[model samples]
Target: MAKVRSMFREVLLKQGQLSVEDVTTMVMCKPKLLPLKSLTLAKLENMQQAAQDTVRQQEMAEKENGK
Candidate 1:
């Protein structure tokens, strides 16, 4: 099956032997459940919360020192 090095003598359809007859059928599958939030988004939220907590603690310490 290695003889198609033609210099163009014209091929009028005579290379048929790759039969892949597929019948269509309805396939009811599970609905793809996706995460409400992505990994990066969740991580960013956690980081933001941690940063806010740290800032709050620092502010509280400042208030205590001022008092």
Candidate 2:
């Protein structure tokens, strides 16, 4: 598990998706994003962020259309 986590962390860092501080922050919030199997905690957080942005954009579009 440690090796897997390390590799995934390196990939995310290299891809510029996460910074050192972000990794530390996620480590502290691991429990909150638990019950995850396929994705590591960091990836889960990224997915959550993407989902939130999508929802926000959709809501804005809806409001604009209704206006």
Q: Tens digit of lDDT per residue, candidate 2, span 1-67?
A: 4534453433434454653553444334444554545557779889899999999999999999999
Which digits, one per residue and each the tens of the lDDT, describe model 1 over residues 1-67? 6876867585465786655569999999999999999999999999999999999999999999999
By TM-score, the best candidate is 1
Best candidate (score: lDDT)? 1
| C-alpha positional error of residue 55 in candidate 1 after TM-score superposition, expressed in Å | 0.5
Model 2: lDDT equals: 0.72
RMSD (Å) per prediction = 10.8, 24.1
User: Model 2 compared with the native: what TM-score?
Assistant: 0.42
- Error (Å) of candidate 2 at residue 31 is 24
lDDT of each: 0.90, 0.72
